[model samples]
Target: MEQLNNTFVAVQAASRQLALLNSKQINNILVAVADAIMEQSLFLLAENEKDLTRMDKADPKFDRLMLTEERLKGIATDMRNVAELPSPLGKVLKENIRPNGIRLKKISVPFGVIGIIYEARPNVSFDVFSLCLKSGNACVLKGGSDADFSNRAIISVIHSVLKKFDTDPHIVELLPADRQATSELLHAVGYVDLIIPRGSSNLINFVRQNASIPVIETGAGICHTYFDEYGDTTKGAAIINNAKTRRVSVCNALDCLIIDEKRLNDLPLLCEKLKKNNVIIYADAKAYRALQSSYPAELLHPATTESFGTEFLSYAMAVKTIKSMDAALEHIQTYGSKHSECIITEDKSRAELFTKVVDAACVYTNVSTAFTDGAQFGLGAEIGISTQKLHARGPMGLEEITSYKWIIEGDGQIRK
Candidate 1:
């Protein structure tokens, strides 16, 4: 408890100094960190392998936990991209002078110290650090036990870079991978300005329910892609296949496929690509009959009521057959996690309606839900995809992590 408290205090203190750094200084540290990651890729991967050996290869989190050389290179590239982007701090959001000679300006500022609790994904260590530092907020990371070895190795590399630049290493702290550490972080009220949980719905819910500090809910993508009667089979198949199988462990991966009942004949064609990937299909009665002739008999099953709202996080998907666009919308609204949703249609009006009406961070028209990413969205990289409609509701970039302050200047005019 004492050690965790000390970590919190040090991070909170360091945040003040971090926020005072000029953009060039911050950018230089980021660039050096990126260079160091590439330099030590082999060592990082070796440590990651230690964590991987402990888990079953078939676990959905195995993919997320495992880190490769190519993935390290990608992580390095994203850090460099963050370095090139302008800092989110000190931007003037609004400025005005009142009749009482009081000039007020709303300027972007850091959240001070942020606490992030995530599971399995060690890459999140680098991502959250770069984003928090770029946005002028210090972060305390609580990575899951599943990625303990990996997270430790990654944080060591980051600390080395921070020390090389003469910056306080406490600016980014990684807590012990234990339940006790999690308890401490959740209750660090004054020390942590915000707590963002990035992982499964269970993890996010635990943090939201327990944290004494402000919480920003992220992760848990029960995404859906709707196929309208007007949808082109070729386009729909390609889009759905890519969205579902491109990276099943990711948050944007599709979990449900809503098909217009009028397009039942097109279902087999729409699901043809999925067969090559050996995807498991859990279909409702209507969709079951439509896919029985085409999909693999072994991989196909009748979907239970629980299948519709599930975040599979695996090579499995639920299919629901609907009679109209309204039915499609209703099904999505009832089951979607509001992370990402897509509609593949040649009809312009239907596409527009889907894009406008679907409540999600990223709503797509004839595009794959796989595009719901920070780097892909051109925000350099993201802390996470925010699903709630609050301060942030999409790919949370540097700007999303920051808060604003009201700066007031007086001209010595006192009212009687």
Candidate 2:
């Protein structure tokens, strides 16, 4: 407990120094870190392979855990992009002169120290660090045991870059990959300003229920896409195929397909590409009958009540048939995880309605839910896709990680 407390205290202390660094200095550090990642890509991959060998290749998280040279390059590119973006700190959100000779200004500031507890995805270590550094916030990472080797390697590279710049490496600390460390970080109330958990629903729930600090829920994407009666079969097929198979382990990957009852005839054609990819389909009665002749018997199964709301994180999806647009909306409301939802329709009114009424962070019209990403949305890179609607609602980037403070200046005005 004492060692964990010391780590937290050091991180909190280093945050003040990190916040004082000018934007140029921070950006230079970020660029250096990105370059360092690329330089040590081979080492990072070897360490990642060590972790990968312990897990089954069939596990969905295996894809997320495994890192290739291409992926490392992408991570580096994201870091460079973050460096190129404008800093969110010190921005004046509001300013006013009071009647009592006092001036007030609300300016953006860092959250002091952010504690992130995530599972399996080692890339998150690099991502959260880049975002927190760019936004002038210190971060304490609690990575799961599944990717401990990878996270350690990534953190070492980051520390080397920080040392090269004469910056305190404790500004970004990685806690031990153990349950005790997680407990310590969660209870570091005075030290950590916020806790963001990015992983499965169970993990997010555990953090939310257990953490003493403020929590921001992310990950666990039970996303859905509605194929309206007026949806183009070709476009719907292409969109569903890309969203499901592009990268099944991602949070934005579609899990449920809502089909307008009138569009049942188009279901088979819409799912043709999915069949080619060998995606398993869990269909309700109506959809099952519709797909009976077209879809492969081995890949098709009757969806249980539990299927609709599941985040497969694999080559699998649930199909629900709705009688009307209202039914589709109701279905989505019942099962959607509020992460991302999409509608493919030729009718503009229906599209507009879906975009407006669907309770999701990201609502799409004729596009894949896979576009719900921080970098893809032009925010450089995201810390996570927040499902909660309080401080943050969607992709958490630099600005999302920051909080604001009211600075008041008085000219010898005393209150009665």
Candidate 3:
């Protein structure tokens, strides 16, 4: 508790200093961070290897935790891109002049001290720092213990750049990887303005249930994709395969697959493709029976009730059948995580209906759900894809990290 309290004090003080920095200075720091990452690639890789050696290779989070030199370059590229993005602070969202000659403007501003708790992915340390700094917010990071060594190395590189710029390194602090300190972060309400959790369901839920500070949910992706009666089987199969296997250890990966009953014949073809990828399918009664003869018995299993809503962040996926678009929408409402949902259909009206009825941050038509990313959406880098609809939703970039303030000017105007 004492450590957390001191960390919060430093963060709050740094937020004030951060607010005073010019956009050019921030961009320069970000560029320097990118360069530092490239220069320290070997050091970072050595640190990352320590964490990787400790983790099981078969674990779902292993892929996310392991950072290769190529991945480091990608992270560096993203940081440079973030530095080039427009500054998120002090933008006038709206302006007005009243009949009494008073001027008013709604301007974008930072949320002060931002707390981010995440797991597995060491690159997220860089992403969160880039977005928070660009938006003029100080961050307190609580990374998973699994990637402690990697995160420390990455944060050291960032801190070096901050020191080079004569900025307070506390502006972006990584908290101790202890569970007790994490719990303390959840209760730092007055100090941390907002908290964003980006990891598995258990982690997100723990932060949501225990935090006294405001939280923006960013993980638990029980995402889905439906194949309509009018959908092209080839396209649908391809989309589903890419969405599931492109990167299985991500929050945006497809978890559940809904098929139109009219197109049940297409199941065999889909099963064949999934089999090639070594994907395990947990199917409902009907789907189980249909897939038994088509897919390998080893990869096919009957799904329990718990399987439907579960976010299997691995090669396993759930399968179900629905009669119509309405049924698909209803099933999604019940099991979906509101992260990313998709429909593969040639019918325009059906696609429109699916997009309209589904309540998710990102809804796609005839496309893979794997594209649900901040960079893919042309937003540079992101903190996370927010599942909640409060302050921010979807891919959280610099703009999403910022709040707004109203600026008013008057000539001695009084209200009665």
Query: Candidates' TM-scores?
Result: 0.99, 0.99, 0.97
Q: The CA-based lDDT of model 2 is what?
A: 0.94
Candidate 1 residues 187-296, lDDT tens each?
Answer: 99889999999999999999999989999999599999999999999889899999999999999999999998999999999899999999999999999999998888
What stretches of model 1 exceed 4 Å from their correct place? none
**Candidates' C-alpha lDDT:** 0.94, 0.94, 0.91
Query: How far is 132's C-alpha from truth in model 3 (Å)?
Result: 0.5
Candidate 1, which ten residues in sequence have the lowest lDDT sum? 407-416
Write the residue-wise lDDT of candidate 3 on 6-123 in tens digits.
9899999999999889989999999999999989999999999999999999999999999998998998899889999999898999999999989999999999999999998999
RMSD of each: 0.9, 0.9, 1.4
Error of 1 at 326 (Å): 1.1
Clash pairs, model 1 backbone: none
